[model samples]
Target chain A: MTETPAKPPARARIPLGQRETVAGYLFLLPNMIGFLIFTAFAVVASAAISLTSWDLLSDPEFVGFQNYIELLTDDPLFRTVLWNTFYFTFVSVPVSTALALGLALMFNTGLRAIPLFRAMYFLPVITATVVVALIWRWFFNPDFGILNYVLYELGVDSPPNWLATRTWAMPSVIILSVWKQVGYNMVIFLAGLQAIPTTLYEAASIDGAGRWQRFRNITLPLLTPTTFFVLVISIIGSLQVFDAVLVLTDGGPANATRTIVYHIWEEAFVFLEMGYAAAVAWILFIMVFLVTLLQWKLQKRWVHYEA
Target chain B: MTAHGMNRRRFVLTTAAAGGAAATVANDASASSGAVSSRFHAPAMIGQAQTTLTWAVPGNPDEIAVYESLAEEFMSANPDIAVTLDSEAADFEKFVTLVAAGTPPDIGFATLYNWPSFAERGIFLALDDYIAQDSYDLEDFYEQIITPYRYNGDTFGEGELYGLPKEIAIRAMYFNMDIFEAAGITEMPTPDDVWDWDRFIEMTQQTTIEEGGRTRQYGYVQDVRWTFWQIWAWSAGGDPVDNLYKPTMSTLDNPAVLEGYQVFTDFVTSLGTAPPAAVTADQGHSEMFAAGLAASYNNGRWMVPLFRESDFRWDVMPMPMKTQRAQTLSGSMFGICNGTDNPDEAWRFLSYVVGAEGQTRMTELGLLLPSRKSVAESDLFLNSAPPTNNRIFLDELEFAKPLPLTPIYPELEKVINDQTDLVLIGEKTAAEAVAEMHTQFNALLQGA
Candidate 1:
């Protein structure tokens, strides 16, 4: 042992860059493993389970594409829910996007306490969907609600029974969703508005352009890329709407507010039809995918990258 | 019966009902005597070989505290078996996750909402063997209350026993005397007071008041819950389904059911009496009633503790009757898990919780209508009333029907509501809604 001690150990060399990369990966190893298991693996498992009949309590029985077929052809609720999801997307995306843009323009005037105003506008986006829904639910109450009281004062004989009728239920849920979502979109639009070159506005004003004309000619064109991005994301987000409908109407007043995701939850948790829920989830994924793809395809015609 | 049991903690010593299932409870009869029955309660095992039981029940903090105190009392009596509370056990998703992971609590909970279906899925252990071995006195519980827990593969109440009912939620019409007097009605409901549907409607109309296109006072405020709606269908002499358990057809199209559905739907859409469904979306019917906005409210005993703080004088009354009287029964129960490694020990805990001692403790809080007849009829409940007619809860149990429970109940609930919502919105007649319900219900039933 004493003779062997004379021979010192040889040091293995590793490049600093490679060592850093290895250390970085090691730091991420735990989270990466977690993500792979919980997100990636679960997603794949869900896709496979979509082909089986599982009740969560029993062993899954493989049924090939039967779940998909049932949902597409035989399940009437599926069609109504899918149509409801699209209706929500088409209506909510534009309304929230336009409202967000309007807020961005109003707040971009270098007003005092602009951050405070922006924060106030974005408050609902960060608030719990359930808490806001409960408060809005009070506002929409047909009996003793402020909304009805105002309608009565305005001499409208009858205010629509919000969240209680086939026609008004979805709109009530839509209004709440728009209220919740507009804040987030407004922040993004505010960023887009600030990024526009101030010189363009100055030059246009010097050319005797009025405020409206300046916005129409210079600001609108320059903001098209941002608008396109907002549209794509808002459309995708709108298609996946769940929490508002859940807390507000619970896909009810005759499934009027029932969206694709609420239906998936009902199938999986409430009905214990996990396989059917997975199939519904997959269908929702496809719809969101196709709609986003279409939006991306259409963006090239209107999206402007120039300042 | 033992004379010494009279001095035991179970103060109610009413003679047990005469029935085939009547039994001689050992420890209960000799509770104060120097003896122990359960293995863990044996004198030799005092502070020795121990087993801990996890009891999962869904409850708010206050309710869980009630359970926890009882659990503490149980553990002190049986030092060898420590009982722990898992309040999260009440959530269905969490319950499923626990079961899936093979870590289900020794004791589990189920409601009429999912009890039968969960039993069918084998999530719980059968209790007949345990009951027979222990000779447990189930005759103390109402037959109808216990019937719902007896599942025979295809139907409940026909085969093997599966649970010990904790309590039943049987709702009755609670009338506010102040509103009734203001409406110029001097009649208060007697215990035997059973109003016909027409009489009930007349009273409701009289109670309703409107000012400036707004309802100043609602005649009656009933929850739009499908379970409540089903009472209208049943009390109108409509079966709603050929079979109560796992019904394969919808009798919602029956003329009587359609009649019940129309009258109830019209209460909101056309009558201008009850507020629109949106009122409930924003505020519960009970809250509205409690706030003195409604003359009468329909609810369960659980509301008593909350409603006691109300300013108005209110009393529970018998529900309106049509061709027959009907009320809805929804209940929760506890049973041993099938995966439990210690079934005997689990049974010891379950039998104790559902025993007379435990139910009496829970009911003392004015939050339960115990399945045990003695507890329900005792001074603890029947006499602890501003209702003055608290017996209505007890009497109405005679006419109560269990909420329709099928393996596909959640779907059936949606199927019924989807169509009924149309009726409530004036978009469809009861007949049309029933037609739609028939198609959807049959499909779900056959699929299940």
Candidate 2:
């Protein structure tokens, strides 16, 4: 026993200060509760309902994957909605993000009245979605509309019926959505741009780097975190785009603008097929989740953070 | 009888009127006492305390004034119950969202068509108890007006009374006098004067005017979903909904309906007498007519003020018939919500709405035909300005058919609009569109 005691027992250590841990946990509580309420439990409940069949009035009857099987194999409307949503997401996100970043860069310069220009650019972000949709609808109007009128003056023949024509309807909505949302993302990008230390750019410039080289090495790399954030958020948002479509198109011109979320709404509330709609909602959530996860996984290669 | 006995009988009748099918709420006399009874006559008893109850309505500024006046009258009668009328005014769509959201106002003005959706959601209360207890008269409400409230022949809510029909719009046509004169059509289109398919087109063509090489004014304008086409569909003997909850599009694909569609499209496009694609182009033909751009417009009686305010002189007539004379019955109803904490208060408000006093007051506003058949026959609505021929709407009440009552109307409407728009824009033929519509509508129905 004396010989074993010679090998000195190691003392168990306790952290003296809990300020960092407490602050971290305190900050985390809000998100944890929010996720539990809005996302986690919702997912579970919705998934359970998805496996069953129910309208709002009747109690749910468990159908055991019948809805999913039908959604995957049989439902023609589902395919159309999936296509529309994918088309919208694929087209809108990049165009809007690039435009926002460009605008942010333009406003972030050391120019006079930058704040005024920023405010003007952010006007659409602050305006109500319904108002934006209405104004855009009028602008895109065929006969008395300012859009077609301008095109007529420019000597272009046969301007498309923006809301009424199938070919142009989604494009029209996409344009409206980008215009409405770009201002919000631009503000975020501007904040990210401002946070980039000037020293890096100066160092790059001194090392025989041209303007393009300096930007390539410094600005883009430094802005990756912000870009990643915007990408994730924008993707999530575009998947759920409803108000503009509801106001402007009502999923018209042969259901071209009928996104997945719109289909869910139409199915659940309008058609009163609650169980099938719950299935649709769960499917949408999974799709959005996977897409976000994929982006997160990809971010390891592209996104760089200092700390 | 003693004054107390008379009041007791009055309370019994009111309860009967409020309770729909299975209630004898006259026995709930004790419940009506206490807080409910006090709130019911709070204004008369308390002499003014100023409590505001929310009211929802539709239409623009002037129409809002009518509600404001109604609110003022209700407040004046009940000084304790202050009222605030919150108007949606823009379109029926927002009202749907609000009601569906489950936080519907204390008092709301909504079309009866929307009541089924609300009732199915268990959001509305059965007013039968209130009616029976209050001794309100049920017979005053026209049978046709209260039809929508009945689900499986049971009134909306737990009892008979859910909503009272405040305003109704049986389909009517507005004819331009100048166009009629120019067309050499001396006889006005009337309920008695049923025009066949060819004559209707001929009359429309005769009235069409061309100026500056462009079609300035069309002979007629009608939308695919609203007033005129609905009448056409009815006249061709097609019911969109059967007795069962099935959509009857493909089942009733008579050639006459297609022929009617052809006639409508040819008039607008091939004949060049009407604005091309006008049916799919505008929200309603009344707007076109109001702008002095169309000869005749088929719409509801609500368009009277639009006509009156317009520079053109217009008069309304019964919608022209093809096979059997018919007009689509369109109207609104009032219902009490089951979740309402103040059913007695709501019953009191509804009593005034359905009573002769309220119906007469609404009639005087000249915005709608009152749901009471007696009110329609009265000089009150008929003698009003805008020259509403109240008799034509009332006379056609027998021929008035309600649209398909299904919870799936919004879906059905979308499919119909999409298909019809395709046809109007020359993307599909009438037969093709009808077939497509039948398929999609059935899929929705079966899916439901």
Candidate 3:
């Protein structure tokens, strides 16, 4: 009893509770400062710069809301840029999620080679986007590429020049994007799959449920949260696609594969229009914000939760 | 010690290495003065009040070594001044940021196309005062090449000189001797005979050998990255822009310009004699030529070092003719940053490197279409064999035109290429693409 009462006073010497709080904040100080300086400061600075007319060399001249107005009403290329971004997001996000879900479902079985197959699928997710894009460029080559060779062997006459033609260039980029992205989503989906109780599946199987029925009734209803998560992030990621566009086609074949982020980089670095680039960046930020908000709001309709 | 040594250190080396990089030789009894061989590893420090000038060295290890040697030599001459070589300043954005931050290198170099745009923003110090004071023969350099680097408050040429040309690159055609002979092309493209666009196309078509669907050997392949295709329009008396320095209109809509654009675009699209972007998609067109997959490749002297390593036999010739004759005149250049503290010291060093001796030493890099008239014409430049037609490079300078670079050059290039790419891919005709060019170019050129 004396020792038990003495424990409170003994702990008072070190002050673990208060010390932990201070130490936790102390440990986080470096990262917090970095985030505030590099990211938060940049974000606010760009928002201010969006209202100015500054080339890199000159002092920023305030232009109010004129840049946003110009982007919306004047710049013809902005329309193309937005359209291309939407096309990429809408196509790449859905295709990647669906393919990843399918991969998760197939590999969920307790097969001996599951780990091997998982690693093989996840290999591209870890490879550098630049290396992947460069290799994809070779594969996209119409004449000497393995892609065209395979197509030829399949008796498909006159395969399209994947990166050189306007119609096929965006699709080629989307294909590359989906391929690089699918593995990451699949791993996430696998985690979601593992969390689902096998007992529920077994009960459903005993109830004379078919493979399709159980997948629909129990698995799908439970997986809605994961699906929603995957959809939101994939959509956000697709809108900001830059490295692949830069390395693979360079927004070429007559600006066919030019995306919003790619245009922002070009305007800021290549054209030296810092203010204009910030305006475009703000536009992109708003777009991502609104899309994510819509998905978050709409999740109530399809997203299921358990008690 | 020699009593005259102290006085000789102050004697500036404003002259170009009229002979070689080591023009100072050992004539000076002072060992710290241009004794490159013995003092190259470390320039012997002699005098005090040492002013360190930072110079941006933007090249490979071999290039850095040469530039470092140049610095060592300069330091030996002016022992009072030390030079620091910074490779990071080589980046355009970083350099501009450093300038804006008010801590730019004393001397900086960038592609010639960037100088006018950079100068317009007052990024570089105007060297007119220095040139006048030194009675430095600006005439020692090619007038046409140097003229493009001049910038006033508004336009280029007829203004204060902004910088000096570092080296030059003039375009010529490279034909694989093996493929040409195999295709029965005995007569090389003669600068005198001056084959027309139609004749060039016919010759390429004859050499093109296709098997079933695959092109076994491409007749010709040109990289679409550069503005080298302007050779077609230029030879036909068609100007892509009204003036090279301050272009207000995109004259691609002109009859002759369209004729040039159409003929060049037709080679890949309608003609199919030259490799399309699809054929050369995996490899650069230059690499494709060096590999003997193409009969001829059109480029400047920059490709010489790469082509030299190839096992195949190849030679050079001037490009085909239209109504007029012309080729490209574009290269990199060096300038003193506006923020430089030691302008006098920087100029002495800059002038020497771009001068005859410096250019002769640079030719060791194997691609100095030397900026100095003396160096370009000297036996030092002419002796590099295998090209055989080196004389044509100098002769073409009469018609060499720099690209119409302006404050909006990077944007202008993207605008022009975006539309031209459409034409080349057969998505649109020359007239259609030019219509787009006119719309975009007016916005860019006049916007400035």
Best by lDDT: 1
**Cα distance off (Å), candidate 1, residue A185:** 1.4
TM-score of each: 0.89, 0.77, 0.88
Off by over 4 Å in 1: A1-12, A203-209, A305-307, B1-50, B245-249
Off by over 4 Å in 2: A1-44, A197-218, B1-139, B147-163, B175-220, B226-228, B241-250, B265-295, B305-312, B337-349, B387-392, B407-411, B439-448
- List the TM values for chain B, per candidate: 0.88, 0.80, 0.87
The candidate maximizing TM-score is: 1
CAPRI rating of model 2 = incorrect
Ranking the candidates on TM-score from highest down gives: 1, 3, 2
Q: On a 0 to 100 scale, what is the lDDT of residue B299 in model 2?
A: 65
lDDT of 2 by residue, B21-118 (tens): 11333223223222233444456554554455555544433444555556566666767675444444112334444554555666655454455566
Worst 10 residues of 3 chain B by lDDT: B1-10
By DockQ, the best candidate is 1
Clashes of each: 0, 29, 1
Q: DockQ (C-alpha) of model 1?
A: 0.34
Candidate 3 stretches greater than 4 Å from native: A1-15, A109-113, A305-307, B1-52, B60-62, B72-84, B132-139, B189-193, B356-358
Please report the interface RMSD of model 2 to 1 decimal. Answer: 11.8
* Alpha-carbon deviation at B152 in model 1, angstroms: 1.9
Clashes of 1: 0
Report the CA-based lDDT of candidate 3 relative to the real structure.
0.78
On lDDT, the stronger of 2 and 3 is: 3
Give model 3's TM-score versus the native structure.
0.88
